[model samples]
Target: MKTTGNTILVTGGGSGIGLALAQRWHDAGNKVIVTGRNAEKLQAAIAGRPNMSAVSLDVTDADAIAAFAKDIVARFPNLNVLVNNAGIMNAEDVSAKRDLTQAEATVVTNILGPVRLIDALVDHLAVQADSAIVNVTSGLAFVPFPKAPTYSATKAAMHSYSVALRIQLEGKVEVIELAPPAVRTDLTPGQSTREGYMPLDDFADEVMTLFAVEPTPEEILVQNVMPLRTAEANGTVPQVLERLKAL
Candidate 1:
């Protein structure tokens, strides 16, 4: 994707990595529109950024996404980039009594949400000369985090889906999968900040820099995520499991 001059729509752009990326693009003179579940947060995100706009959207709602796609095409005809960044992470105990309903909610938001959004916008994206779709996955996709099994599985599914989407849209649009390591975001509440995940601004900077140079669709893994990728590629799942246990 081109580094600048594109109208981009980012899901879950109210806070964390999504807002950070939106801010960077807006500062670079691009038109940026952000969508999230909370109207208040979305409004706050674009308050001081003249080039940035916000829309309230819940990715988990299929009908809502269908309507959103139409609204986007009608309202933001110049939009060429779509960022699938909304996701949820939750810790669940498999052995203990658990509510399957809660796990399903995570699956819907993390996996089905992107799938539905892309399906709704694929045609619109194809019509653009320089279009891109960015899917924010996670390092846990390669190696599952025991505490957040459902969340990991959803990200793994997203990673797989992104690969397929890229192939399907080969010449139509650029598909980039950004698999971030633990970032200092609200996704983990207080834990992420305390656990030394990459700072939000630092990760966003690296991602934008990578986009400026790379033309082809590829996975952008930040510093801490490299080990997980390597271990998975080398068939060292057991060793990685041991390391996770130690953590």
Candidate 2:
């Protein structure tokens, strides 16, 4: 993926990792458009960056996603990059809970949302010269986090989907999975300032550096995530899984 001169659309760009990435791309002379569910948050994100624009979108709404894709294609004809960053994370108890509504919501937002958006935009993307699809998954995908069981499962599903999508679109469009470790974002709330989470700016910087390089279609893993990726490759994933279960 080229770092500059591309019209990029980032979902959930109002805050956290999404906004940080949008800001970085905007600064690098790219036409960046960010989308979110909240109008106020979107406005706030675009206020400081003149090169960035904001669109109101709720990825969970399938009908709204369809409309958004049509409008975006008509409005920004040069759009070649789609960043599937919009997602939700929640903790739920499966044992005591009567309803799995929270888990269902997580599956919808974290898994189906990106799938629907990609389905809606693939045709437009295929026609573009150097199009790319960047899917934002989590380090939890490699090893589940018991506390956020459903959230972790959804990300794992996304990781699987991204691999298949990349293979299918091999020659037509570039598909990249950005599996971030615990980052300093509202997604983890109190844990953002904790010991292990990577700073938002630092994460964004590393991603930009990776993007500057040509089509390397590999998962962009950061700092702490390297150990997990390495362990999985070395067949020590079972041990890592046991450690996470203990957590």
Candidate 3:
């Protein structure tokens, strides 16, 4: 994918990794539109920025996604990049009976949200030059994080989905899966300042650098994430599991 000059739409871009990547793309000369459920947060994210805008969107709403797709295409006809970055993570106890609300919400927002959005915009993207779809999974997808089991499962599903989507869109649209490590972001309470997690700014900087590579990699795996990403293949799952347990 080209590093600049494309109109990009990033979901869940009001804060954290989404906002970071959107800002970097904007700085790189892309017209970036970020969407989030919080209108105020969205506005704040784009404040004092030109060629960067915001729209309110609830990815869990199928009807809203359909409408947003049509409207966005009409507004930015050259929009060719879609970043599926919005996700939620919740710690759940599997040892006892518990409310499934968080689990269900995770499934909808983390898995179905990207699937539906891709369905809505794939046709439009296919017709555009230099089109790309970036699916943000997680390092936990490769190695399940027991504390956020549902969140891990959803990302794992997305990883598989991205593989299939890439094959299906082979010639027309590029499908990239960006699997992040445990970055210090507020995806969960107190995670933003978590001791062991990678700093948000550091992760985002590495990500932007990776994006600048010619013939960009299909999977954007930062150094900090490599352990989790390769644990299974390297036969180090047990060691990785022990490390996660310590966390």
Which candidate comes out best when scored by TM-score?
A: 3
* Pairs with steric clashes in candidate 3: none
lDDT of 2 by residue, 6-56 (tens): 999999999999999998899999899999998998888888778789999
Note the Cα lDDT for every prediction shown: 0.89, 0.88, 0.95
**Which candidate tops lDDT?**
3
TM-score of each prediction: 0.96, 0.94, 0.99
Candidate 3 overall Cα lDDT vs. reference? Answer: 0.95
Off by over 4 Å in 1: none
Give per-residue lDDT, candidate 2, residue 126: 99
Off by over 4 Å in 3: none
Give the lDDT of residue 89 in candidate 3. Answer: 94
Candidate 1 local lDDT, 1-247, one digit each (tens): 8878899999999989998999899999899999999999999999888989988899999999999999989999989999999998888889988788879999999989999999999999999979999999998899999888999999999999989988999999989999988788888769556666788888999888877775643898777788787886798988887877665
Candidate 2 matches the true fold with a TM-score of 0.94
CA RMSD per model (angstroms): 1.3, 1.6, 0.7
TM-score of 3: 0.99
